[model samples]
Target: MFRARSRTGATFLALAALVVSACSSGSSTSSASSPAAQAAELAALPEATPSALAPYYGQKLRWRSCGVPGFECTTLRAPLDYARTDAGDVRLAVARKKATGPGKRLGSLLVNPGGPGGSAIGYLQSYAGIGYPAQVRARYDMVAVDPRGVARSEPVECLDGRKMDAYTLTDVTPDDQREVDGLVDAYKGFAEGCGADAPELLRHVSTVDAARDMDILRAALGDRKLTYVGASYGTFLGATYAGLYPKRVGRLVLDGAMDPTLPARRLNLEQTAGFETAFKAFAKDCVRQAGCPLGGRGTRPEQAGRNLKAFFDKLDAKPLPTGDADGRRLTESLAATGVIAAMYDEAAWQQLREALTAAMKKNDGAGLLVLSDGYYEREADGRYSNLMYANAAVNCLDLPPAFGTPEDVRKSLPTFEKASPVFGEALAWAALNCAYWPVAATGEPHRIEARGAAPIVVVGTTRDPATPYRWAQSLSRQLSSGRLLTYDGDGHTAYGRGSECIDRTINTYLVRGTPPTDGKRCS
Candidate 1:
C-alpha cells in the first residue's frame, strides 16, 4: 500500500525505538473575507443546521473515564450515509483531555495524525493529549475522533494475520508474468475480503464522508467553529472540511499537506520521487557514519542508492530468515517497506543504518522485519491492525485507481523508474492494488478554495518522503486563506518534530489565532 504515514504523534518513532533495541537499529488567500464577515455569512447559511442532520448535531456526548489518567472517551453517532438520513448511524470513538487551564479556555482543539486509517483517538491518548505544548494544552481541550471505518470505530478488516502476512510478502517488483499474476491476485483477494467484510461501510469511507463526520463531531462538542491540526493524509481531510464549511474553519494547521488537484497517477509518481529524495538524504548521512553498509565516507548518494537497490535485488532472489514465530521471512517488499518507514523521520536514519547493517552484514533480517511490522502495525502475537485495510478503503474510494490494469502499470514503469530507480518499480506496482478495488471512486482531483474560511496554516518539509513539499505549495496556492510555512528539513511533517521555529509559529497560531505571515520559511 502507498502510505503517507503520520509523523505528528511520533507513533512510528516509538515503534522504531523498540526495533533498534532488537537489532541495534536505531493555506492561501484569494478570499479577502474578514473573520467577522465570514462569521456573519456562516450564521446565514442554512446547511449549517439542516433538519436531516439535526438529530446528529443535537446529540450530546456522555464522556466517562477511559482508563487513561487524564482523558475521557465517548461515542459519536453520525449517519452512515450523509445523503440518506434514514440509513443507520456509525458510532465514532472520541477522546479528549480537558484543558489544564492556567489560561482562559479555548474551544476544543481537534487533531488527526494522518493515516486516513490512523486512530485519531489513539494518537490523542498516546501523544497529543500529553505531548502537545503545555501552554496550548493549558488553554484548549485536546480532542480527537477516530473517523468512520478506523480504529475503535467499526474498523474495516480485510484479512486475518496469516493472510496479511502472505499479502505483504507478495513480490511488488515483479519480473515475470507469473510474479505479476501473483501480485494482482493478492490485491484482488484483499479487496474482495473488504467487500465481504463491510460492503456498505466501504463505500462511505471517502475523505469527504470523513469531513462531514467532523462537522457532526464539532456540533456535538458544542463548538461553533473547528480548531484543528491534521498531518499528512489528515491535511486532505481538514482541507475538505474547510471547503465544505468555509466559515466554520478556525485555527487549522495542515502540516505535511497534500495537493487535492493531482490525479492518482501524478500523486504516486511524485511520492515515488519524494522517497528517492529522502533516501538520498539518508544515504548522504549514512556514508558519514561508522559501519555504514551502503558505502564509506566518499560514496556518492547515487552510488549509495545503487548499493541499497542491489541488496533488495538479492533479497528478491533469496529471502532472509526473520526468526518470526509465524515462519515469515524478510522479502524484498518487506525490506523496502522497512526502509521507507524510516524515511518518514530523520531520527530513524540511525535505525535504518542499523537495520541495513544487520540485514546485509550479519545476515539477520529480524531488525528489518521489526521495522516493516511497525509500518504495518502488526502486533507480536501475529494480529494485524486495521490500518492498512482502512487505508486502502479510504484511498481507493477518494480517488480513481492509478492503474486500470497490469498493462497500465507496465506502460507506466519507465516514467515511475525515472522518478526513483530504487523505489519506483515497487511503488508503481503497488499503485495497482487499488485497481482491483471492489468500489469505484466517488471523488476526483479538484482544488479546495475554502473561499471565505479563516486563515489556515500549511507546513511542509523539503524532503518529506510521502508527501512532497511541492504539494504544500500547490495546496497553499489553492486555498483562499492559506499561509505557507516551509521547513527546510527532512521528515514527513513539521510541527512537534523538534523544530522550535516551526513549533513556535504553529503554537502561536493555535493559541492566539495569529497565523504566520504568508510565505513564511522556517529552518
Candidate 2:
C-alpha cells in the first residue's frame, strides 16, 4: 500500500517536530539578535560568484506557449549536480501564467505544494496558477518550476508498474518470519532498483541542491527576490532556500512547516502518533453516523483499534483475494496504506468506510486495493509513478535513516508503539525502510534560521497528520519574523480546500502583504 503523507495542518506541522521539551532542548545561549542584526548577518555572507554560477547561467531556455491559456512553458537548465556544475546539465520544466488586471505588478509568485515529489507544474496548472485569488494573480505572475529529481525534471523511477503493484501489496506488518523476510527483500530490491536506474541523479537530489536551483530560477525569471507559497514538504524547500539566501526572501509563506532539527526516527514516530490522533478523531465522528464500521457496534474507539489490529492479523495469516486478473491480494501492509490514504483528505472518509466495510465483511479486497493504488500512483496500465521512488530517494538523502538495523527498530518499537498504539508498529516498520538505504544522508538536523526574511506567514493545523501542529509553532518561533495562522481543523492543507477563512487570510497576505496577526484562528 502506498503511504500518502498526511495533509492536515496538524500533520504537516508535525513535520516540524513537536515543540515539546525534548525537541526544544538547550542550545548555546548565543546573544539573541534583533531583526536588523539578522538582516546584517544575511548581508555579510559572501555573494554567489558568477564564475561559480556560470554553468547554471550560461544554459539557454526554449520558451513557448503552453497547454493552459495565457500560460507559457519553458525548460531551464541546471547542473545535474550542483557541486559539479561543469559535469552536466538537467532540464527543469517551468510554467507561468502572467499577471493580469488593474494593479501594478509584483514580481513572480512561485508556488510549490509540497511532495518533495509533487509535480509543481501540475500544481500550478491545476490549482495555484489558475485558482489562486484573481487579485493576487493580477499583480503577480503565478510561477512553478519542477524541482530536480521530480516530475518533468528527469524524475527517478524504480520499479515498473507491474513490479510496483506486487511490491506495494507486500505486508509491512509481518506476522511471521517469511512475511518479514519478504518485506526486507522488498526493501532491498527497491533500493537496488533505484541505484541501478538513476545512480548519478539519486545521489545529487538533496533539498539544499533543490533550493539552489530555486535561486537560479529566481534570477532567470527576472525577480530580484523570490515570493513563494510552499506547502507540506515544500515548506522544507522554502525554509532551506531562506537559510541559503535569507536576504533574497520576499513574502514567503511556509504552510505545513517541517521541523528541520529532528532526525528521521523522531520525525517518523511523531508522524505515526499524528496518524493515531487523526484516526481517533475520525472514529469519534464515525460513531455519530449510521452504518459506522468501527463504532455504533457497541465498540469504543480503543476497542475498534483492537479490532482493526485483529483484522490485519487475520489478513496476515491468509492474504485475501483482490479479484484482479493478475491475482493480486490484500495483505496487512495494503490495508494500513489504504487507511493512511484516507487521512490525507477527510473527504475520502466516506470512501474509506465503504472500502473498510467491504473488506471486513466479505474478505473481498478490491476496494482497499484501489485506495492503495491511488496513493501509490499506480496507472491503470500498470505503470507506476516515480512518486514513491522519488519520495524515498529524497527523504533518505535529506536526513539519516531512522534506524541502523532491524534490531535498532526493535529497540525503538516500544516508543513508536506508545506514540500511536494503533498504527505505531506498521509506521515504525515502514520507517525502517531507510535503514537499508544505499546512500548516506547529505544533510543533518539544524535550525533553518531564516532570519532576514520579511513577515513570513506560517500556517499550522491543530490536528495535522503528516506535519504535527507543534511543528508550525516551532517554525513560527524559529523564524525571525514569522506570523502564525491557525487552522483549527482537519485535512492536509487548509488553503483552497473549502475554508473561506483560510483562503481569504492567505490571499490577503499574498496580494496585499498584510499577514494575518499571529495566533489568528480560522475554522
Candidate 3:
C-alpha cells in the first residue's frame, strides 16, 4: 500500500546513494523587553494565547549544544490535547543553528520537511542546518521541531520489525476474496497495533494539534511573528498554522503543496494521477536511454507503462529473490513501492532505469529492494524508523478514511484506474489502510483562508509525483494572501531541486521579505 509520505531532500539524497550502491544507493525571537511591549505583542498575536496555555507559551528553552556542530537542541512541552489543557505534557524535540550574520537577523526561520512523519529536527541536523542557501543561513537562525508523534518526539510505535516487514509485503492488488481479506486483515492489525501501543497519544496527534505546538514553539523562541519554509506534507502544516494564526505569519514558503480542501479520496486519486504524470515523464526519458528496460527509443509512454505493469504482474505470480538477509523477495507490492519512491525526484530516474534493467532483464532484485527499503526508512539492521507509523498516525487523524471498507475501494476502482491505469488498483487499495483506524478523524477537508497573513509564497512543481501541481494551485487560490510560484519542472519539491529561478525567487523572498509577483513562473 502507498504510504503517501512526502519525501524530504535528505531522504532523497540518502536514497540516491542506495540506488548507486544497490544499484546502488529556524529562527527566534528575543526575551528582554518592556512588560507593556510584551503585553501589546501578546495582544497583537493572531489568536490570543489562552490562559491555560500560558505556561507552555511562557516556558524557556534551554538550548544545549547537540552533537551536531553549530546546532543546539532543546525540548518544548506542549499539552497532550489542546482542548484538554490539564492533560499531561508531550515533550517535542527541537534543534537550531544560530544565524551567522553580517546583515540584520530576520528572526527565527522554522523548517519542516513534510512527512507528516518526517523528523523536523532530523532535517535540521542533516540538511537544512547546512544545505540551505548560504545567504539564508547567514541571516536567519535555522530551526526545526519534530512534530508530535514523529522522530525524537514522543514517537508512536505499532508493529515490531518482523511484523512490519510482513505488512510491507502484503499484497495490495487483491484478485480474490481471500486475498482481499488478507489485505484488510493487515490494515486491521496495523491499526490495532498502534492503538495497543499508544492509546492515549494516538488521539492527540492531529495536524491541528501539531500546528498548535508550532505556535507554542514560536512563543518560546521570542519571535513576534514566524518566518518559515515547509515542503510536502509540511505545506499543509504551514497552511494550517497560517489559518490559525494569520496575523502571526511573517514570511512563509510552501513548496510541493497539498490542497487541504480535498477529502482523502480525492487527494489519493489526484496523487495517483500525479504519480502517473511523473511516471510518464520517467518513461519518456527512459526510452531515450541506452538500456531502458520498459522500452527502447521511440516507444510511447503508455506502452512503457503497460510493459512495467506486466512486469509487476509477473512478480505478483512469482516473486524474485532480492538477496535480502531477511529472506524477503521482490513481490509486486515491494516492487511498486521501489518505483514510487524514485518518482519523488528526477535525479533518481537514471538509477531507476538501472534498477529496472537489473530486475527485469537480469534476475537480480536487490536494486529495486534498496529503493523500497529507503522509501520505508528501513535500516540495514531490520529495524524500521517511526516514519511509517507516524505517517499513519497523523494522516488517519487528519481525515476520515478514504474508503471505509474493501467494497468502498472496489467501487472506486474505475475512477482510480482512469486516473492511473498502472498504479490505480494498488493506490486505491492503499487508501483502505485508514479504514480500520482506531481513532475517529478529528479533521475534515476545508479551505484555508489565512486572511490577514503576510503574503505566503506557494511553490508548485508541475510534475511533483506525490503532491500534484494542481494542489499547489488550489492552495494558493484558497489563501487570501497567497502568491503562487510555479516551477515548470519534475520532482516532489521545487526549491533546492536545482531550478535557479525557483531558488532565487524563494531566497529573495525569504531574505528580503518580498514575495515573487503573484502567479510568477520559474524554470
Candidate 4:
C-alpha cells in the first residue's frame, strides 16, 4: 500500500490534466451534464441478483493441513472469464482457520489486508488469520485469498532483481531533457518487462476483475453473502465488490478507504500530500526527542522538512555506499523513497531518525536500504517480489493513466511541490510513469453507491501516509451505509496495528454483526 503512491488526490489532480487530454478525444455521449445528475445516475445502479451457487463450492476446496494448528488450505478454481463460466480456469489460493470455540459458527469471514498487491493469504496466516480476538475467531472462520495477479495467484513479474535495484535507485526528478528521456526509458522498460513476462495475465488482473473473483470465492465458501474486511487498496476492492454486488454485501469493513471517484493523477498527488502530513506528525514528535537529527530545541516540522530536502540534494550528487554483497548504493531518490516508506507506520519513525543520523553523521545507509527493500518486498537471496510490478499493473488498470507525457508532469510539479514541498518533485515524476503504460485503462472515476448494504465501517488515520484521511471522508460520504471510524493517530491502516479500541470495535462487529457507532473515535 505504501508503494502504491498514485492513489492520493494530489496525484489524481496532477493526472487530471492528462485525464483532460484523454477525455478530450473521448466523448461522454450521456445527457447528464452536471455532477449532481451523474452522481444520481450512478446511485441508481441495480442491486445484485441472487443466483443459486454451484454445488461444487466445497469440492474445489482441496483442504490440506496447514502449518498452523486447526487451519486448512484450499485451491479454488474460478473461470478466467465471469461472463463465460466455461472459460479457462484460474486458481485462487485460500487459507482458513476454523472456529475453535464451542459457539456455533456464524460464517466465513473473508479478509484482504490490501495492496491490490498485498498477499492476503500471507497476511491472514501471519497476522489477521491468527491474531484476531478469540471471540471473533470462535464464531467465524478466518479466511484470506490473494487477488488475481498477486502473490500465489499467478503472480506478475517485471525486471530481474539486479535490474529492479537499478530501477528503484533511478532519479525521478530530471533536470534536463536527457535526464527526462532516461526517466521515460525507465518507465518504458518497466512496462515492457511486465508485458514480456506476464502479458496474458496483466489485462485480467484489474480490480474489477478481482472483485468478480471475490464473488466467486464468496459462493465457493458457501456463504450466502460476502463478509469482508479490506484495508488501503483493499478498501477499494471491497467497495468495488459492493458496487458490483451490493445485495451480497453482508457485513463489510472498509478501513482506509480509497475514493474510487478520483482520477489517477489526483490520487497520486493527494497521496504525496498525505505523506507530507504524516511526516509533519513525525517531525513534531521528533523535536521532542533528544539527539533529534533535524533539530532538538523547539524546531518545527517545516524546518525538519527543509533540512531533509537539503540532505537529499547532497546525496543526489554523491550517493552513500551500503557495503552490502549486492553492492546496492543508496541514491537520493532511493533514500527519499525509503523515508516515505517508513512514514506509513509511526512505529518505524524512531528507526527513520536513526537512518537519517547514520546517513548524515556517519554516511551509512543500511537502515534506509532495509526500509526500501521492505517496501519493494525484496527477498534475502537478492530476488525481488512482484509487489511493485503488480501494484502498477492493477493501479494502471483501476484508473486511467495519471499523465500522458513528462511535459504534463513538468506542468504539475509546482502544484505537487505546493502540496508537499519536501517530496513533491519525486512524487510528481513517479505519477508520470503510468502515462507510458502499454495498455489503456478500462476504468473511470465514479462514486460507488453501495446502498442497501449493512453498516460498513470506514477507518481513517489523521496522519496516514498512504490512503489520506480525506479519502476516507469522501468514501464514507459516497457510501449510503458507511460509518466513519476515526483513528486520531499515525499508520497505514488503523485496525490491529495497535489500537485496542479499534480492535475491539471491529472484532465485535465481525463476531456479533454489530457495527461500531458512526463517527467513533479511537486514539
Q: How many residue pairs clash in each candidate?
A: 5, 19, 19, 19
TM-score of each: 0.93, 0.90, 0.92, 0.91
Q: Rate the local accuracy (lDDT) of all candidates.
A: 0.81, 0.72, 0.81, 0.74
Per-residue CA lDDT of model 3 for 1-523, tens digit only, reads 1232346311221211111100000000111322112211111234677899899999999999889889999999999988898989999999999999879988899999887778888888888889999999999999999999989999999989999899888988999999999988988998999999899999999888898899999999999999999988888889889988999999999988877766566666777788899999999999998889998999999999999999999999999998999999999888888898888888999888888999999968999999989888899999998887787788778767677778887988888888888888887777777778898877766678888789999999898887789888878987889999999988888888888999999999999988999999988
Runs in model 4 lying further than 4 Å from the true structure: 1-59, 66-70, 84-87
Of the two candidates 1 and 2, the one with more favorable TM-score, higher being better, is: 1
Deviation from truth (RMSD, Å), model 2: 5.2
RMSD (Å) per prediction: 6.8, 5.2, 8.8, 4.5
- The Cα RMSD of model 3 versus the native structure comes to 8.8
What is candidate 1's lDDT per residue for 1-523, written digit by digit as tens? 2344463111221111111101010011112322222221111133548888899999999999999999999999999997898989899999999999898999999999887778898889888999999999999999999989998999999899998888888888889999999988988998999999999999898888889899989989999999999998889889889988898999999999887766666666677788899999999999998789999999999999999999999999999998989899988988988898899889988888999999999889999999888888899999988877787788778767767788987888888788888988887777676677898888766678888899999998998877889889878887899999999999888889989999999999998889999999989
lDDT of 2: 0.72
* Per-residue lDDT of candidate 4, residues 1-523 (tens digit): 2433212111121122211111111122122333222433133334443242253244456689868776788887766655555556678888998887779988888888766667888788877767877887888899988888778888888889888777877777688999889888888898899889877677777778888778878877789999988877778888888887777889898887787766556666677787789889889988899988888869988999999889888888898988768887888877886787777777888999999888888999888878777766788888876667777777776666666778777877888898888988887777776676676777777778777777888988887878889888878888889889999988777887889999988888877788888889999
- Preferred candidate (lDDT higher): 2 or 3: 3
Range of the 10 consecutive residues with the lowest summed lDDT in candidate 1:
18-27
What ordering of candidates by lDDT runs from best to worst?
1, 3, 4, 2
Candidate 3 lDDT trough over 10 residues, lowest sum: 19-28
